[model samples]
Target: MPSEAPPTDFSVARIHETVLQMLGAGVLPPVVQAGHPVLRQAAALFDGQLNAEELGQLIHLMRSVMRRAPGVGLAAPQLGIPLQVAVLEDEFDVDPEAAAVRGREPLPFFAMLNPHVRPSGTASVAFYEGCLSVNGLQAAVARPENVEVDFTAPDGTRQQRSFSGWQARIVQHETDHLHGILYLDRAELRSLSNNAEYSARWAQPDIGRARQELGFLPG
Candidate 1:
């Protein structure tokens, strides 16, 4: 005998119920609105002189805010402190085709701190960027397709590396956050409004796919 498939309505209802329960439990924080002083202020650099406890506190604060927020990235300024640091997680790996596939690899999680970016290679424009500090808004922005950045690890180890595509964009975006710039500041509002007529897309997601034969899922 075969089992029956679950209904989509039931699935959505269960997810909604879980979210409501979490909200009631105080796992989420009220989103900070636009024009907040912190959101507008430029962050300061990590003094390179923080003790272990101080560094630990910064990390914890960033993690806590990120966990409670819907945005994919956040900066120290959003927390009312101006500091040259930010944290992000790339979680947009939704592929419709993968639903019927046997196996798909997962993307790794990362945290970048005090990152400095240089326009070493190509530049490109990406659209539909939103930020935790600036909620309820998105804009099309132009950025370098590739960049080289230097920074210290969370453990204070110095490191420099080059990145391309989405990685580069994420780094650039966070770097701007440290410099007191929001996505709206660099937004191509005119182009974005007319994007339907003249579309120039950005964002490259499939660089490290475990399988290439799998096609993209329908939107």
Candidate 2:
């Protein structure tokens, strides 16, 4: 007798059942922390891994978690699902000078499925970044100031757009999550600081000050 082919429908159904069960049970697990293996592994492409209703539940769960975590972004790997999905939104609560320098602005919530991001220009900028997974720490990381992003929208439409400034940073960070990359990987390690210390010392939008103080050049 030949070996049986794996039941792909059964697998997808199992995942769907598990996700819905968690949501229906109203017992959402905390976001997966940094040391988890899921965070280190590249997430799977989100090809119909979830049906419409299941995807909605997952997105709702993610949106709620990100907002409550009070974070600007959250990725599926952060929830231990290991799918290439993430959500991002920024309320833009900074002072005028900071907002202007960083090009910060209010960003409505958006979901990215199987996102791909690439640099749109050679210009790069550095900023202090923190993640919900790696709580209580911020570090300086330089990235392309503009990027082109391609992803699937919630309604199942394929989309592509360009982003710049702070929004670009957010997109890159979340996309990196899908690729098993963390800001810490590209961060100027010397510029690492606790949240309070970061606020007290390097809160300025200019990261050059942090580079001077921390004795490392921005990437």
lDDT of each: 0.56, 0.83
Cα TM-score of candidate 1 = 0.65
For residues 81-161, could you state the per-residue lDDT of candidate 2 as single tens digits? 777889999984789898899888787899999888889979988888999889889998889999999999988899998
How does each model score on TM-score? 0.65, 0.90
Candidate 1 lDDT, 1-219, residue by residue in tens: 112222212233343343344334544344456686655555555655345655565656666677677545667656545556677665656564531131223324456677889987565635345677665455556677778999877787889987766666777887876766677777655423332322233222321121122222211
How many clashing residue pairs appear in each of the predictions shown? 5, 0
**Against the true structure, whose lDDT is highest?**
2
Query: Which of the numbered candidates is closest to the native, going by highest TM-score?
Result: 2
Off by over 4 Å in 1: 1-31, 96-107, 191-219
